[model samples]
Target: MTVSRTRRAWIAGLMLALAGGLTPARADEPVTVFAAASLKNALDEASAAWTQETAKTTRISYAGSNALAKQIEAGAPADLFVSADLAWMDYAEKNGTIRSETRVNLLRNAIVLVAPKGSTQKVALEPGVDLAKALAGGRLAMGNVEAVPAGKYGKAALEKLGAWDGVRTQVAQAENVRAALLLVARGEAPLGIVYATDAASEPGVEVVATFPEGSHPPIVYPAALTKESRNADAAAFLTYLRSPAARPFFERQGFGVIGTEKRS
Candidate 1:
């Protein structure tokens, strides 16, 4: 028999209560969100604005989309999930970890080549650009290309530009895009591939060039409520994220707000 939404929520709460031998949290408790690391600055500001406006508290955890999706799969008590790409959000939906009806494309970003501040590395991201030679024997910092959304997008852009093969052996993979950005910011790596917003947030790094949108899969950020979310305020927070008030914060950080529209 098909269960109703109310029944399913009750069952989920019961299961969690039974598992922990404790009562479910009150409806007004803080909303917890698992978000992509690249969204730190804007999201934090937006969330703070929400709190200031409504007096509702939020707890946001930032990490790689792959890591956040896996955490949701493992039953982390997160009310919302914001991913850097559609793939991991699709994975969460396929795994039954997110509410399919609540999912929406939220924001967009572009990948860029970044170098430490004061470095005179001028790069044109055209086909067959000698990215390896620009590295000067230094490594290119990127998130784990196998999983992290930023890394996957960076790799795709590099491959499309015919530069991946030349520098594939010189990549220094990090746990997340922010970590890779740090590698460049700290001068541990001579160059890095990160979102344009990331390069803007860190004064220590300067953007060399932005990858063509056609060079890689569109960098779309999708947000959704987790299947296990029971906080009464969680849905409101998700809605607030798409509201007009939140648009400025994201735009100020170089993100394109997609509103309720889905990317084609």
Candidate 2:
């Protein structure tokens, strides 16, 4: 007997819920997550574990946090958002796109200078260091300094170290941190500034020097439920992201989990 389309959809949803170990929601829709591109590896692993353990599935979209935030403001149907920095999260909060009560600062990261895996380049990321001289005529790659968080942080650090002015003309800005990392890994750029976790995730690159913490604002990843979310499983999955079960995946990818700080 041929099942009706509606009935077939229900059955499929039920099977998915059972496989994920989660109770069926009002609708069988998967929780949709918008996250930073830098989180691709670790978050994918964490979501996979959550699906395996709970039988609930998540649909994640990874892009630059600035782009994701803009999409959310434009009414994208995201159940959860994980930003690479606090500023975008704050932007979402101010725009009433995310649930203030569900917001939390979930992770911390560090910025570093990186070179292709076998390159022998090193420079102290301190005031008065001649970053342009160290570049040896190669451009420094980073995220878009005006919008992307990684680029903003890299620019801030350089400014603090008095290097921004000299190297501004030599910088190659990518759309996001991952793109910048790829540029370095592909040898398109001799050096790149990116999060330490990003460098760890790419085998073709190596950290040349870590930016001093005081050189820039702290790198924090903030996560929250979107006000537009309709899926009941979203909150549970968000909690799972911070659980011990998910910690290993994040830590393995070089992300440091921060204690949850609820907004409201």
TM-scores for every predicted model: 0.91, 0.89
lDDT of each: 0.95, 0.92
Best by lDDT: 1
Q: Residue 139 in candidate 1 has what lDDT? A: 98
User: What is the C-alpha lDDT profile of model 1 across 134-157, one tens digit per residue?
Assistant: 999999999999999999999999
- Candidate 2: RMSD to truth: 5.9
lDDT of 2 by residue, 1-264 (tens): 989999999899889878977555565578999999999999999999888988888899999999999999999989999999989999999999999989998888999999999998878877899999989899999999999999999999999999999999999999999999999999999899999999999999999999999999999999999987768899999999888888899999999888566543
lDDT of 2: 0.92
